[model samples]
Target: MNGPTRRGDLFDDVDGARRFTGPTTGDERRMLIDVLRAQRSTLRLKCSGLGPELSLRSAEPSALSLLGLVRHLADVERRWFRQVLAGQDAPPLFSSTTDPDGDFDGATDDPQVVAAAWEAWRTEVAFAEQFVTGAPGLDIEGEDSWRGTVSLRWVLIHMIEEYARHNGHADLLRERIDGAIGL
Candidate 1:
């Protein structure tokens, strides 16, 4: 409890809370996107100030590390925005024949890899944000093979959930790496 608990950490500030003001015709598009953005920001905040060692250190069997989280998120963002939504045929950002979770597992004690993970994560996040902002009209009736008929709003919300879940894992990993804690 040195700083803010990462569990309930979501929004950075309430200044633009009005983004979700009024009804969205029952669509929580802006709200959901804002929520996702907040979670991503929280992830960045948690990873801030750490050097290559702590950032990439995996304290357990799982590839759950700060650097890994960054890489995974970048891959996720790129997949959703560039591939699925934009209908591109791009390959995965991380994971290859040599190593599965390369983004996470491949983060050596090297400064280059750590820096690349952070940069890729930021770039992908920006791209994803722009894509969502320019998203087509909300369509809850639409269908996906995996999610099935969910709105872009729902997709955004789920992405928030995904990031939040992994961020929760990251919180614990980071805490173990060092005594540092907070949103």
Candidate 2:
């Protein structure tokens, strides 16, 4: 309640700070990227003013915490963009087959854990952004073992969906943590 949420948190004016313009009209690629960027910024906004509370779980049966969401999304980003799309051997930073829920289950209320989650999320996001920027076109195809064949467009839409869904959960978790709420 006294100082900025953390050392470098700039959620005071998330839109102004992050430059997340939710542009409604543009080419398909630009629009998709902008929307995804907006969704990503929304996640940051939802978690902006908290430190340890990022690890607060919602209910007894659910391991759904804001920190968990961050970690899980980090894994998701790595899986989709790095492994599936870019054909990199990037294993998830948090989860493994033996413990698929490690992202959520390991979301301890420790500063180090929170920092790692944010770092991994940001790194994966950066890679995804760069991949999108460098791609020849949205029609570029990638072979996904599960989905068979996926295009950049499909991946972008899926990432947007993933973030949007998790951001909704983030909204609730943030409100539960401190009664602060907003889109």
State TM-scores per candidate. Answer: 0.76, 0.90
Stretches > 4 Å off in candidate 1: 1-27, 56-58, 140-150
Total backbone clashes of model 1? Answer: 2
| Cα lDDT, model 1, residue 66 | 81
Clash count per candidate: 2, 0
TM-score of 2: 0.90
Over 1-183, each residue of candidate 2 has an lDDT whose tens digit, in order, gives: 676453222235646355455567868899999989988888888888689999999999999999999999999999989998899998888899999999999999899999999999999999999999999999988889899999999999999999989988997888788777665
lDDT assessment of candidate 1 = 0.70
Error of 2 at 80 (Å): 0.9
Tell how far residue 78 is off in model 1, in angstroms. Answer: 0.9
Global Cα RMSD, each model: 5.3, 5.6
Off by over 4 Å in 2: 1-20
lDDT of 1 by residue, 58-168 (tens): 555666678888888888787666766666775667876577678777766688888888788888888877877787655523444476456666667678889889878
Scanning candidate 2 in windows of ten residues, the lowest lDDT window is 5-14
